[model samples]
Structures are given as structure tokens and as C-alpha cells.
Target chain A: MFYREAGQFKSTYQTDQAIFPIVQDRWFMALVFIVAFVVIPLVADEYWHQAIIIPFLILALAAIGLNILTGYAGLVSLGTGAFMAVGAYSTYKMSTAFPDLNIIIIFLLSGVFAAMVGMVFGAPSLRIKGFYLAVATLAAQFFILWVFNKVEWFFNYSPSGTITAPPRELFGVLVTGPEASPVARYYVCLVFLVVFAFAAKNMARGRLGRSWMAIRDMDIAAEIIGIRPLQTKLSAFGISSFYCGVAGALYIFCWLGSAETEAFDILNVSFPVLFMVIIGGLGSVLGAILGAAFITLMPIFLTNAPPMIGIHLAADLQKHIEEIILGLMIITFLIVEPAGFNRLWQIAKEKIRKWPFPY
Target chain B: MSAEPTVGRKIGDVILDVANVSLSFGGVRALNGVSFDVNEGEVRAIIGPNGAGKSSMLNCINGFYKPTEGMITFKGESHHQMETYESASQGIARTFQNIALFKGMTTLDNIMTGRNLQMKKNFLWQALYFGPALKEELENREVVEKVIDFLEIESIRKTVVGRLPYGLQKRVELARALAAEPDMLLLDEPMAGMNHEEKEDMCRYILDVNDEFGTTIVLIEHDMSVVMDISDRVVVLDYGEKIADGTPDEVRANQRVVDAYLGVQHD
Candidate 1:
């Protein structure tokens, strides 16, 4: 009943076009802010921060990136893992080359690098579409990883054939390397998530967002209507890669501490991010985060739940079962509600709007 | 027809002139040496039987299909072939025969996209979505709402065009075109599948657009009554050729056009 918007009347287009137009939605968002910033840090344990929450936030950012391209822009990309590596490796090089520079600036600059690479790969989209385009991006996935793996310069000539994120500080707080506390890293990831999430939402609802959706829905019509297909599609690639690149940097510096190319393997990073977008909901910022949370926590739940119930299974067997269940869930969601968890949430809200009666 | 005078409305000099245009696909000719001109602020109609290349003519005009030969002059700038997006940049907008709307978006958003050319904020400002970006968005929304009100589609502004009925979808497509504030509008089969009431409503909207905005209209329609009533002039095409071009009454009386619509006796 409290979810109703019966009394609110928008007197101006500004109020009507506000992200959260309803008063209730604005209050709910404020409450969520307080919980994320204040309550979670106070109540949650270190394991939750380290093993679950931090990774969830970072992956959510990556999912947002994919959602922008594949979801909003109607372009398919399977090279997210490689795009993330672009961010991680570039950050590695930058932090080492300019040790005194702030990590935040490094992250932003790393994103720009990834955006450029993304545009290079995205050039083929102008000539190809659908499965052909997916294949093209898949080539990007393999090609980018191969380049990073082969090039000694990318890893700073590390014998291990990996890039390690050097310790970095943001405003005097240690937020990277082994010495950084889980809370500090969590805060860093959280700040990036909140700010980018806001920005993503802004882009999704504005003119650029409309153009992306236009290209996705009907390219011929979009072209006839004057939306430049090349520019719009490239922008999606550039922006999406920018987001994934930042997330990748955060993945190494804020969460993983150190990583090999294997950490960004297609099965490991790319597929999971794609699954999160599909299961969470495409074309929705909140959906991207929700999907990331679901995919991130499911594995942890599978490993812990059975042992707690005194029904312990072999580790490998548990892993296989988790994969099967995830596969099944994806199939079911595709058939049942392809819009993913976001649509479910929307339906629930719609129900709440008409609570205590079915009409 | 209702007694609406043309005293204040001025039909000015030629806005679009198609000179000796021909289009072909492989060995098949679609439009063969068809030529016509549209005056500013007048409703012009192109009518023909099925397979008469009426739509092909529209496609050529809007730069979707480059003519194999001939020149199209819009606002006195002549070109051998026009680019697809160049039409919009040059103040020409159109709807498709198949109702090509952005199905995933709401009616309002679809229309708002028409104002994309007018919106000046860059992507950086769009990302921030505050200060100037928000101000620009609101200003554009006001304009879109005016279009929504004009088309009497306010009730369905938030409804996705994909789920709307066929007639409403057609109206939304028209609204999207009008959102551009085009100097000329090209409508292909606007009232093709509508019932009598819906067709009446569409005719009223099309006439209002021409009357109020002074937008030059070049429409390809099948309804002969509607063509004869609203169009200031009509051009008839038959089997990839121009059969007749004159005022609606004059074309209706032409012997070749009568033969094109009704069968001609073999010699």
C-alpha cells in the first residue's frame, strides 16, 4: 500500500523526467544508500567483505558495461574478459610508470585505453550483425588475450607471465596491494560502483540511450531517422569498454590483489559477466547489479550450504552440480522471463502499487 | 469537404523536384524515368496499383535506394544520389510502409528520438545528466509533449509502440516523423490497414500537420477517396512509369490513369 503513487502529480517535465519520479522511490534509494555505506560496513564480517561483497560490486560494474553494449545497444560482445585485461594490464603499467599518481586517475585513464581498443574491435560491427558479430567479438576475446600473453612489455617482463597490481593509495588511504584492508578496498569498489551506476542510469535515460536503443531495435529505421549508425555503435563499444576496463582494474587492485591472464579467461570472466547480464536483466542498471549479486553469491552458497547441512559432497562434484544448476536457471529464465530478474522486480512493484486488491 | 479556406495558407515554390529518376534491381526495373515536383505547403499524393513502383519512388526520394539515373533536387540542391541519413540532416523525414518504429521503446521515447538532431548536449553532459543536460532534456520533452498533445496520443505516451494496436503504432510513427520538425514529410501507406474511423483520424492529423506546420507532404496512399479529397495534386504511376500528373480531379479524369486502375481493352 505504501508503494502507491496516487497522490503525486508532476507539475513540470523536470520532475516527471527525474530518474526516480515517485517520492517513494527516492526515499527507498536514500535508505539503500545508508545501508550500503553505513550499515553494511558496521555489521558485515571481513569474509563477507573480502569473499563476497567486494567481488560482487566489481563484477556488477562489468555487467553494467556489457549491458550497455549488448543490452541497450543491441551489439553482442564476448570479449569482456579481454577488455578487463586491457584495464588491468594498463593500470599495472601506469601505476609502475607513475608511482606518485593517484589510483583513481589511473583507473579513469586505464578505462580510456580500453575504450580505444574496444572501438578498434567494434569496427567490424558496422559490416556484421548478430551471430556473425558475436564471432567477430569472440575473435577479439582470443586475439586480445593472446597479445597480452605473448607481449613481455604488457607484464613488465615478469617471469611469471602475469601482471601484478602494485600497491596504490587514494587520498592517503592504502586501497591496493597485500597490505590494504578488506574494508578499504570495499570502500573503493563501492565508490566506483555508486558513481558509475548513477552515470550509467543517466546515460540510459537520455538522448544517447535512445539512440542506442534505436540502433538495437531497427537499424534501417534508425539510419533513415538520422542516427549515425557507426558513431552510435562505436560509442556503445567505447563506453561499455570503459566501464569494463575500470571494473577490471578494480578486480585486480581492489579485490584479487594479484592476477594472471587466466583470471580473465573467457570461461572465468566473460561468460559469468554475460550470464549476470542475462539473468539480472538487460537494459537496466539496477538489473546489472542484481545479476552480479546473484551470480557471485550462488557459487558461495552451493559450497557452503550442503556442508552446513551435514551432507558434504566432494568439491569437484559440488562444482559440477553448481554449473548444472546455473545452466538450468539460464534456460528457464530465457524461456520464462527473458527480461531477467529486473522484470520480476518490476512486476512485484506493479503488484505493490495495486496492493490489497487485484484488478 | 469542410469549408476551410486557404487564404492564410500559402503554397510556395517547388521544394522537391525529381527529374528523370530510374531505379533498377539486377535486371528488373522498379521505377523508369518518373519525374514529379512538390510545392511547399501542399499535400501531394502518389497512387498506383500493386507493383506499380509507388513505394520505390518514395525510397528513391528519401535516399534509401539510389536511382540508377537522374537527379533529385531538394531546396535547389541537386544530387545524383543521396545518402540515407542525409535526408534527415537536410530536413526530410519519413514513415515506412511496414511501420518501422523502435518497438522496445515507449511512444514518448520513440518521438523524443525524433528530436535527437535538435538536442545539443554532448555525451559527457548526457552521462552527468544534470545541470545543462537535464535542462536540455526537459526543453525537448516539452516539445515532444506538444506533439503528443497535437496527435492526441497523450494517453498512450508511456505505452510501448510494440504492444499498441496497428493504427496507434502508425500514429506513433507519424508523431516520430513530426518530432523532427521536417521541411518535408514522406508517408508510405499511412492508412493502409486502418478502419474507416482510424483512416478519418489519420487524414485529419495529416491535414492538420500540413496546415499548421506548413510541412510539404509527399504521400503514397491506396485509398482513392482520401487521395482525391486531401491531396492538392496527384501523380499516377503504372508498371515503372509515370502515367499521369495533375490536380486530383484532372488525374481522376485522365484516360491513361483510368486504364491503369481499371483494365484497358486489348487492341
Candidate 2:
């Protein structure tokens, strides 16, 4: 079974400390990576890459960001969409102003800008908590998007009031824009996603991650134990925003190729990402990826399957059906396994490990 | 043990001094002109009936509640107007009346979090999860492991505090507090909801923490026997006024304390 993680033993601290200590799980991950990087590029067409893979990667990154805030730090934020807009606009401004600069540097630096904005919004958490903090973040969402829309400089004073992704090259290879190859774009996203995912995994298992969880669980107790709540909460905001910012940059640079102030509408994108975290496991890193993939790919399958089966539906009807299905799926997951897809995967693996013995 | 040093001069060496502290919620006076002193390396017990302003005193010290009028000095430095975070930075650690452990985290993770204030690494190292972050994590783990061993919570190190029995949760909370290695440990009813066995366990831990780490303890407790046994000195309150303050034996013998406990008629 792909989920089985049995009979793995550690001989040293480093081996015990390895991110995934189970032999079966390690092999499963390796195989998944091989399929994604090597096989999918060869077999999958442009539609799959654009519609399913790219969106899935970007959503997974954003989910990770949200999970860091809501799940680990126990701070709920409704401003994720706004943070993404910051990344997109910041990247657009940087690239447009300095067309000769490296695109990769712009993506990373844009994340810092988002981090600063997130920190400012996250300041209210020091004074407020729970539903109040959520409202404060919502303020950030509206305020940031409002600035992006109203401020002419944010869009380079363009008459369209929208920023377009400029054609960019990485190491003499076209990595973005219409002329860029799908394989190259996919590779870029894959490399960043894998590296950051691993980094996040390690961080969550370390001291700082523990601090976030502690604050989430009980701020009073965390404080008595010498944890500075403001510092820890702010740091969670900063790191989570960093991840979301990078994803936002990639959304315009690698996938969407353009952005608008309305690009981060609260309902269409933000709620879906929140659903990903809730349906994935709240506190587990793997759950973020699982939740992102499930939410990202399901609608694609739903949209394409009916048309292929000689049942044609209008565009509006298809969109409505997708929303309904998404809503129902969210409710079902919340009821059946509030811990999210990670718990489901765990249960499946547990059953498989005890195969032929019905326990 | 060496002859107990004269307790007189040292009594004046107050680690925490609350003077003329008064807090009111509209017409209700939670604390009114309350005054007290806590000395270094001493187990100071604050005992009173319900609504006697014991908790308000702790809240003021920890910066949870700002007293309407008064000053609190810790280590000769006034902190009557300090923020909670600032109080923490100034080396104050405290537990709540109710068990406030992080429910979703394991005992180990909860305790490691206590070391948050001590960690000096920045976001760059934390995000990289290499270099100083790794070193810091390992170092903190060593200290956390020691706490786990001290508390005898090794078996349940990985178990979430929420799922543990009440006594274990309380112990884990203490472990988390001790993980901070604080100069002063404020325990609000550390043994509030425990059975005899659990109370005994908690009492032993409190003493060990005091004796081994030399941590100053200021506790609010309801049990007279536990307070008499563990506290170096006792402060008795009645209606937010300091009714009695002295060694446990001395306070127990005080007429006001006797009246507050038994009855005015008995006194």
C-alpha cells in the first residue's frame, strides 16, 4: 500500500530526525516526485499543466501559508487573498521598473513586501483574539485590495488598471510569458515547491514551530512558560505571508500571466484555500498539499467528465455545478473527517499495514 | 542543613512588592489598596476565601490586569504599568487557576515552547532550518528532556495534553512553566482540581522545583494543610485586606486568621 509506513527503525539522531523516517513513505514520496518531474512533463498536455498542475502547486503553497497561521499559530486570517495580491502587484512593479533584473529574485523579494504588510495587519492580534482577530485580518484583505485598486502606481498607471506578466528568461531559457515552454515553467514551480515544502517540514518539527502550536493551544500558558506571544504571532504572520507571497508571484509569472485587483476576490479563491486547510489536517504539513491537490483537481475532473460523456452543459451551469459540488464536498469532509485528507490517508495506510488480518 | 539564617533582614529583601494596589470594575472593587511582599527563593502562599482579591494580585503582577491605582516593583524595579509581554521579558512566569496547556500539542512540544523567550535565532535561521536553528533546537531539546525526566512524564512525552488525565495535565503545565527557567514562578491554584494522590504529586513537584532550581514561588492555594506544609511564609487575606502575614505557624496562630477560617464566635 502507498500509505504503509511500517518497520522503519532509526539507528542515529540524524536518521530519527529525518523528515520522513518510514522506508515505505520515503519511497512513495520519491516515486511521486519522479512521476511529477520526469513522467508528467512527457505525458501530460498543455491543458493539464495549465489547468490542473499549475493551480494545484500554487494552491498548495498558499494552503501551507494559511496552515502556518491558522493551524500552527492558532490565528485565523481572512486576508490571504489580499496578501497574494500584494505579491502579484509587487512583482509586477519590480519587473516593469527593472526589466533587466532576474525574475527569480523578484519573486523572492516580493515575498518580503507581503511579509511586511502581513506583519502590520497581524499587529492587532496582540490586543485581540479569536473571532476578533479574524475580523482584523478581513480588514487587511479589504484595505490591501483597496490600495491596489485605487493607487495608480500599483498598476504602473496603466489605463487598463491591470498588470500583465512580462516575458522573462532564466539563464538564457524562456521561463515565463506565452513563448515559455510548459516543461520549463513546471520545473521552476516544482523545484521551489519541493524545496520550500521540505524546509517547512523541518521548521514545523523544530522549536519555533512548537512555539506557534503552543500559542494556538493556550496563549496564557504559553506566556507563563516565557513565550512572547507578540513576537511568536508576528513571526508566524511573516513566514506564512512569505510563502503566500511567493505563490502569488508565481501565479502571475508562471500560471495566470496577468493579474487584476479583483483577481483575489474573497469568495472565489480565499474560501477555497481555507477549505483546503480544513479538509487537509489543520496542524499537519502534508495535509496542506493533500488538501490543495484535492480541491484544485476535483473541479477540473467534474468540468471535463460530463462533456466527455455526451452530456453538454452551458458555461454558467457548469460553474454553478462546480460550486455546489465544492460546497457539498467541503461539508462532507468536515463532517466525516474534520482532520482532513491527511487523516483519511493515515487511516487507509493503517488498514493496509494490517492487511489480511481485518483488525 | 546550615542553621537557618536570621529571617529578619532577608524579609526586607523583597523580590516583588505591591503597594496601594486597587482595582475596581465600575462599582465593584476587585482589589482595594492591597499590599504584599514576596522575597527571593521563598515559597509565599496567598490564602483567602473566594473574592478576597488573591487572583487580582497575581494578575496585576503578571500584567494581565492594570490596577486602577498602585505600583508593583519586581527586583526593585517598578512594573505597575508594564505590559504583559514586557513583564514576561522582565523574567516573570506564571500558570493559571485552570489548566491552560496547549490541547493539540504533545507534552514535549508544549514544554519546548516555554523556551521561546530564550531562543535567540531569527526568521532567516528558522526558515532555513539549518545552522543555528538546528543547534538551538537540539540544545532546547536537551533542556526539555531534562524537564520530562524530572516530572516523570517520559512515558507520555508524545501524548497530547488534552487527552491526558487531569493530574498529568497540571504536571505538564508545571513542566512548561519550569521550561522557561523563570526567576519567579507564579502558580494560581496549582493543585486546584486534584485528588489526594495527584495533590501529593503536585506538592512534591512544587517543592522539588523550589529546592532543586532555587526558583522563587508565589502560589495561590485553597488547601490549608498543603499551604502550611510547603510555604516558607503565608499571607492571609479577608475582604481584599492583608489579615495576616508571617511564617505558617505564626499565621496559623494569629487570631484574625483563626477567625477568618473557623468563626468570629470561635475566636
Candidate 3:
């Protein structure tokens, strides 16, 4: 009943076109912002900040990126982990090269490098589609990680084949490396996620977003209507990669603190991120974050809740059970609601609009 | 007799000329030696049998398919085949035989995408969606809204095209094409599968589009009555060849067209 838009009429195109046209939605969003920025920072402990909140924000960012390509643009990509690695490694090289430069700038610049690589892989989508396109991106995944693994320059010639995020300060608050507090790292990840998510929402609602959807829904019609397929597909790839790159940088600098190629392998970073995109809902920024939350918390819930129930299981068995449940959940979601959590949320909103009486 | 008056609108010179066009896919011929011209501000129709290559001719005109042999001159520029974007940029828009709307998007967005060529703001502006980008989007939305209003689809503005009924889906497709504000429109069997009421509505819209906007129209239709009523001139195709080309009355009386349509016996 509270989600009604009955009296809040839009007076102009600008008002009508506003992302949250309904007053209730805007208010809800404001409440969410308050809780995320103010309440969480004030109350959350180190474990919550480090293990759950920070990773969720960063993975949500990455999921949004993949959603751009796979969901909106209709390009199936399996190389999200690689794109994130591009961000992580490029940020590593840039920060190490210029220690005095702002770490935030390094993060953004790393995204640019990832965007370039993404566009290169995205070119095959013009001639190929569906599973073929996914295979092409899979090639990107393996190739990018392999490059980072073999090339000493990428890891800054580290003896251990691992790159660690050096300590960095933002506005004199330590935000990275061993000495940085979890609170500082949490704030940094939160701010980056908020800004990038806002930008992603903006682009997805604009002409660029329309072009991507047009390409996704009907490429031939899109091409005939003057939307260049090559440019649109590449832009989706580039922007998606840019977001992933930033997320990768955050994954390393703010969350992981240190990473090797193993961290970004197909099974680890790529599949999990893809799962987040799928479970969250394709083509929705909110879905990406929701999917990230669900995926991130599911394992934590599994690991902790079992002990309380006196159902003691081996760590390895728990891990296997988690995989089985995740697989089953993916299948269930695909069969029941291919649109995932976003569509369900929309359905709920629609139901709320007609509450107390069936329409 | 023309149903609508030509007041304030004169059928000018030929804007599109397809001269001896032939298209072949491997050894199978889709179109063979077909030639036609569309006069500016005139409703030109291409009526043919099922395999007579009507869609192929429309496809060839809009640069969806390259003709194997012939030159297509649009606004005096001649080419073997027009590129898709080039044709779109040149103010040529078309509706498909099957509804080809973006099913996932709302009706408003599907129409808004028709303004893709017109939206010139850069990605940075789009990413931010402020100032120039927002202004451009609202401006284009106005244009798209006018189209939605013209088609009388204001009620279903937010409804996804996939869920719309067949007749409304066709109307939405027309809205998308009209959103481009093209100089010429190539409609392939627009009235196909529509009920009598829907067909009547479609015919009125087509006549209005041509009369109000002065857009040259080249359409392919199976309905003989519709072809006769709105078309300024009709071209009949048979076995990928142009057998008749004239006004509807003249083409209706042509012996070859009658033979093609009614199917004459062979020796």
C-alpha cells in the first residue's frame, strides 16, 4: 500500500524520466543509502566489515559490470574474472610505478585497461553469438590470467608470483595494506560501489542502455535502425570491463589485500561473479547487488547455521554441499524465473501497488 | 481515384530508383531483374505471390540484402547496395514482415531506440546522465511520445512489446518506424494477419502517415483490396520478375497480373 504512485504525478519529461519516478521508491532508496553509509559504518565490527560487507560491495560492482554485457547487451561472457584481474594487475603496476599518485586514480585507470582488453574479446560477438561468444570470452579468461601468471612485469617481478597491495592513504586515512583498519577499507569500498552503481544505473537508463537492449533483443533490427552493432557491443564490453576492473582493484586493495592468479581462476572469481550476476538478475543494477549479497552470505550462513543446529559436518563436505545447493538454486531460479531476483522484486512491487485487493 | 486529396502535398520526382535489380542466394534466386521507382510523397505498393520476392525487394531497398546485379539510386546517389546504417542515416526506415521490436523493453523504449541516429551525446555524458545527456534524452522522448500519441498507444506505453497482442504489436512496430521520422518507409506486409478492424486501422494510419508527413511509402501486401485502396501505384512481381507496374486500376486490368494472381494454365 505504501508503494503507491497515485498522487505523485510527473509534471514534465524530466520528472517522468527520473530513475525513481515514484516518491516512495526515492524515499526507500534514501533509507538504503542512510543505512549503508551511516548505520553500517557506525556499528559493524571488523569481521562483518572484512568478511561480508566489503566483499559484497566489490562483488556487486563486478556483477553489475557483467550484467551490462551479458544481461543488457546480450553478450555471454565467461571472462569476468580475467577482466577483474586486468583491473587488479594494472592497478598494481600503476600504484607500484607511481607510489605518490592517488590509489583511487590508479583504480579508475586500471578499469580503462580492462575496457580495452574487453573490447578486443568482444569483437568476436559481431560474427558469433550465444555459446560461441561465451567460448570467446572463456579464451579471454584463460589468456588474461595466463599472461598475469607468466609475466613478471605484471606482478612487479615479485619472487612469490603474488602481488600485494601496498599501503595507501585516502585523505590521510589508511585504506589499504596490512596497517589499514577494516572500517577504513569498508568506507572506501562502499563509496566506490555507490558511485559506480549510480553511474551504471544512469548509463543503463539512457541512450547507451537503449542501444545495448536493442542489440540484445534484436540485433538485426538494431542495425537496421542505425545502431552500429560493433560499436554498441564493444561499448558494452568496455564499460562492463571497466566496472569489473574497478571491482578487481577493490577486490585486491580493499578486500583481499593480496592476490595471486589462483584467486582469479575460472572456478574462483569468474564462476562466482557469474553466479552473482545470474542470481541477482540480469540487466538490473539492483539485481547485481542483491545477487552478490545472496551469494556472499549463503556460504557464511551454511558454515555457521549448521553448528547451531548440532549438525556437525566436515569442512570439505560443507564445501561440497554449498556447491550442490548453489547449483540446485541456479537451476530452480532458471526454471521458475529466468529474470531472477529483479523480476521477483518487480512482481512484489506491482503486488504492493494493488494490495488489500486483487487486481 | 485517390481517396485523399493532394492539397499542400504534390507527388514530386522519383526519390528511390531500383534499376534492373537481381539478388541471388547461391544458385537460388530471390529477386531477378526487378526494377521499380517510388515517387516522392506517393504510396507505392509491391504485390506478389508468396515466393515472388516481395520481402527481398524491400530488404534490397533498405540495404538488408545486396542485389547481385543492378544499381539502386536514392536521392540521386547510386550504389550496388546500401549499407544498413548508411540507409538509416539517409532517412530510410522500414518495418519487418514479422514484428521485430525489442521484446524485453517497454513500448516507449522500443520507439525511443528509433532515435538512435539522432542521439549524439557521448558515453561520458550518458554515464553521468546529466546536462546534455538528460536534455537530449528528454528531447528525443518528446519526439517518441508524439509517435506513441499518433499511433494511439498511450495506454500501453509502459507495457512490454512481447506481451502485447498481435495487432498492437504491429502498431507498436509502426510507432518505432515512425519514430525515426524517415523520408521514406518500406513496410513489408504491414496488414498481414490483422483482423478486418485492425487492417482498417492500419490502412488509415498508413494513409495518414503519407498524407501528413509526405513520406514516400513502398509496401508489400497480399490483400488485393488494401493494395487497390491506398496505393498510388502498384508493382506486381511473379517468380522474382516484375510483371506489372502502374496505378492499381491499370495493374488490376493487366492480363499478366491476372495470370500471376489467378494462376493461368501452362501448355
Candidate 4:
């Protein structure tokens, strides 16, 4: 069974202390890796990669970023879209300025820029908490988007207040831009996702992550127990922004080669990512990925199903139906299992593991 | 264990000296010019009736609620003016009157958070999750595990603290504070909701912590028997004033303390 950890003995403290101690989970992860790296590339088309996989991966990263701040640190941020814009715009500028730089370097560098912006926005958390902090982050969201719209240098003097991704190569192979192959982009994204996921898992098991959790659970108690609230909150903001920035870079460079300020509009983009986190499960990394994938694919399937089934619905009507279906699914998930799709998956796996026992 | 030390040290050797401390919330004076001295390695209990400003005194000491009018010195350094977060980094750890375990986290995670002040890894290393970050996590885990074992919570190591019983949750909160390895431990009513057995267990733990770790404890408790039993010294407050301060036996026998609890009759 996918959930079983039977017969795995940990002799050392290190093994026992791993983020995931179950042997079954390790094997399942390996299987997932194979499917993502090998089978999906061989079977899936460019349409599937662009319309589903890329958006899924990007949204998953964004959800993870928000989860770090909102779920673990208990600091809600409405300005996630602004932080993402910082990432996208910074990446665009970096790539344009240094045309010879590798795409991966640009992506990582953009995260640093986003981290700074996030820190600036997160400064008010020291003075305020909970709903007040949430409102402060909303201010950041509006302020950042305002800068993107008003400042010409941010968009590299573009008349339309939009930034365009330049063609980029890594090791003499095209990985982004129109000339880049979908498989290459998919692999690059998947690899970074894996690396970041591993790092996030480790961090959550370590001191910094524990600090965030402490602050989330009880800030006063955390202080009395020797945790500095400012440092912990700032760290959460930095890391969460870094993740969002990288995802923003991925969104512009890998999926939508050209984007305007409206690309990061809070209602259209940021709220959807927030919904993904809520629908997946707030504090779990795997839940972020699962929620992203489900949200990404569900809309595509709904839009395309009528045509496949030989029922030709009008395009506008089809779009409306998709939204209605998505809304219903979100409400149903929230009402039935607020922990999201990840919890459902976990329960299903547990049930399978305990088959015939009614556990 | 060594024999109990003599209580003959002068007030001049005081590790914590509060001078003219007063905290007013609007029209009410929570603590009005309250003054006291706590010596090093002494278990000092602050006792008072309801609304006697006992908690306000502790809050001021830890830098939670800044006093409007006085100075508090710890080891000859001003601490009253310091921020609450800074107080923790400066070798102070405390438990709240309310049990404050991170509800969603396991007991181990809650305690590990206490070691946050001591962790030296930066954001870069933390994000990378290798090298110094990994080493720090391992080291911190070792210390946290020691605390867990010390508290005899090995079986419930993975249990989320909120799901635990009240006594165990209180113990977990203490474990979290103790994980800091502080020079001083501040406990706000550690035995408030405990049953007789739980209270006994907690008293043993408190005494053992002081004896084994050499941690100076300052606790606020209403139970006079507990204050007399475990504390080396007791300080009583009434109407935001320091009524008495001495050895537990001395404080117990003080006529003022009796009058505060039983009230005075004027013929």
C-alpha cells in the first residue's frame, strides 16, 4: 500500500528524524518521479504541457510560498501577487540586461529581488498581528502593482506597461521562449520543484520552521519560550517570497512569454493560488502540488469534455460552466474536508493500507 | 543533591532589582511603585489576592508590559526598558499563565521551537537545508530530545500538544521553556488547574529543574501551600504594594499576609 511504513527499521537517529520515515512513502515518491520525468514526457503533447502542467507547477510553487507565511507563521498576506510581480519583473530586467546569463541563474536571482520586496512589506508585522497584518499585506499588494504600472523602468520602458520574456538557453540548449521545447521546460520546472520541495521539507523539520509554527500556534508563548517574533516573521516572509518569486519567473519565462501588469491581478491570479492552498491542505507541501494539479486540470477537462463527447456547447457557455464546476468543487471540498484534497488522498491511502480490517 | 544553601545573602547580591515600578492601565494602577529583589538561584514566589497586580509584576520583569514609572535591573543591567523578544534572547525564558503549546504541532516540535534563540543558521543556509542548517537542526534536536526525556514525555513525543490533557499540556509548555536552557525560568501559575497528583508531579519537576540545572525560578502562584512548599523565598503583594518578602516560613507566619487573606477587624 502507498501509505504503509511496515518492516522499515531505523537504527540511527538521522534515519528516524528524516522528513518522511516511511518506506512506502519513499517508494511512492520514486514512482511519482519516474512518471513525471519519463512517462509524462513520452506520452503528453505540447498542448497538455502548456495548458495544464506548466500552470500546475507554477501554482503549486506559489501555494507553497503562501502556506509558509499564512499557514505556518499564521501571517496572512494579500500582497502575494505583488511579491510575484516583483519576481517576474526582476527576472525580465535581469535577462534583458545580461543577455548572456543562464535562465536558471535569472530565475534564482529574481527570487532575491522578491525576497527584498517581501521583507519591506513584512516589516509591519512587528507592530501588528492577525487581521491587521492581513490588511497591511493588502496595502503592499496595491502599492506594488501601482509601482509596476507607474514606473517605466520596472517594465523596462515598455509603453504598454508589460514585460516580455527573451529567448534564453542553458548549456547551448533552448529552454525558454517560443523556440524552446515543452519537454525541456517541463524537465527544468520539475527538477527545480523537486529540489525546492526537498529544501522546504527539511526546513520545516528544522529550527526555522519550528519557530514559524510556534509563532503561528501562540506568539506570546513563543516569545516567553525564547523565540524572537520579528526574526521568525521576517524569515517566513523572505522564504515565502523567494518561492513566489521563482514561481513568478517560471510563469513568465516558461508559460506566458509576454505579460502585462494585469497578469498578476490579485483576484484573477493570487486568489486562485490561495484557493489552491486551501483546497489542497494548508501546511502540507504535497498538498500544494496536489491542489495545484487538480485545479489546473479540472478546468481544462471541463472546457474540453463537451467537444470530446460530441456535444458542441458555445464557447462562452462552456467557460461559465467551467467556473460553476470549479466553484462547486471548492465549496464541496471546504464543507466536507477543510484540510483539502491532500487529506482526502491521505485518508484514501490509509483505507487501502488497512483493507479488509475496516480501520 | 547538595544540602540547601543558607538564606543569609544580603539584598545587595540581588540578581533582579525592581525600583519604583508602576504600571497603570487607564484609571487603574495595576502595579503602584512595587519594589522587590530576587537573588541568584533563588526560587521566588509572588503571591497576592485577585487583582493584586501579581501578574503585572511578572509581566514587567519579562518586558511584556512596559511599566510607566520604574527601573528593573537584572544582574546590574536595566531590563525593565527592554523589549519582550529581546528579553528572551538575553537568557530569559517563561511560561504563560495560560497553557500556550502550539496546538497543531507535536510536543517535540513545540519544544524544539524553544531552541530558536540559540540557533545560529542564517536564511541562506536554512533555505538550502544543508551544511550549517542541517548541523544546527541535529544539534537542536539532541537538546530538545534531552528535554523530552527529562520531562518523561518519550511516549507522547509525536502527539500534538492540544490533544493532550491539561496537566500534560502544562508540562509541555514547561518543556518548551526549559528547552531554551535559560539562566532564569519564569512560570506564571504553573499549578493552577492541576489535580493533587499532577500538582505533586509538577512540584517535583520544578524542584528538580532548579536543583539539577541551577535555573533560578520566579513563579506566580495563588496556592500558599505550594509557594511555601517549593519556593525558597516568598514575596506577597496587596493593592499593588509589596506587603512582605522573606523565607517561605517567615512569609507564612507574617501577620500582614494573614490580614490580607483573612481581613482586619477594627474595634
Worst 10 residues of 4 chain B by lDDT: B1-10
Highest-lDDT candidate = 1
Contacts from the true interface found in each model, as a fraction, amount to: 0.82, 0.62, 0.88, 0.68
Please list, in the order the candidates appear, how each scores on TM-score for chain B only. 0.96, 0.92, 0.96, 0.92
Candidate 2, residues A136-220, lDDT tens digits: the string is: 9989989999999999999989999988888999989988876788778888888878878877777787877888887888777
What's the lDDT for residue B172 in model 3?
Answer: 93
Question: Residue by residue across B28-113, what tens digits does model 2's lDDT show?
Answer: 88888888888887889999888888988888898888899999999889866766666766777888888888899888888877
lDDT of each: 0.92, 0.84, 0.91, 0.84
How do the residues B1-267 of candidate 3 rate in per-residue lDDT, one tens digit apiece?
354656786799999999999999999998889888989999999998899999999888889898999989899989896677778898899999999999999999999999989999988999899999989999999999999989999999999899999999999999999999999999989999999999999999998899899999999998888888899899999989999999977888888888888455221
The sequence of per-residue lDDT tens digits that candidate 4 reaches over residues B1-267 is: 122553442223578888999999998999988888887777889998988998898889889899999999987788557777878776788888888789989998888888888888876687677777878877888898999999898999988888899989999989989998987889999999888889888888988888778788899997667777778788889999889888876776778987995254221
Model 4: DockQ vs. true structure: 0.59
The candidate 3 chain A region of ten consecutive residues with least summed lDDT is A322-331
Count of backbone clashes, every candidate in sequence: 0, 1, 0, 0
TM-score, cand. 3 vs. native: 0.98
The DockQ of each candidate is: 0.85, 0.47, 0.85, 0.59
Residue range A226-267, candidate 4, lDDT tens digits: 678888899899999999999888888888888987888899
TM-scores for all candidates? 0.98, 0.91, 0.98, 0.94
List of clashing residue pairs for candidate 4: none
Residues A226-258 of candidate 1 have per-residue lDDT tens digits of 999999999999999999999999999888888
Instruction: For model 1, state the Cα shift of residue B225 in Å.
Output: 0.5
Model 4 ranges with Cα > 4 A deviation: A1-3, A158-161, A307-311, A349-355, B1-13, B262-267
Q: Spell out the clash pairs found in candidate 3.
A: none
Candidate 1 residue lDDT tens string, B3-63: 2435567799999999999999999999999999999998999999999999999888888
Which residue runs does candidate 3 get wrong by more than 4 Å?
A: B1-6, B262-267
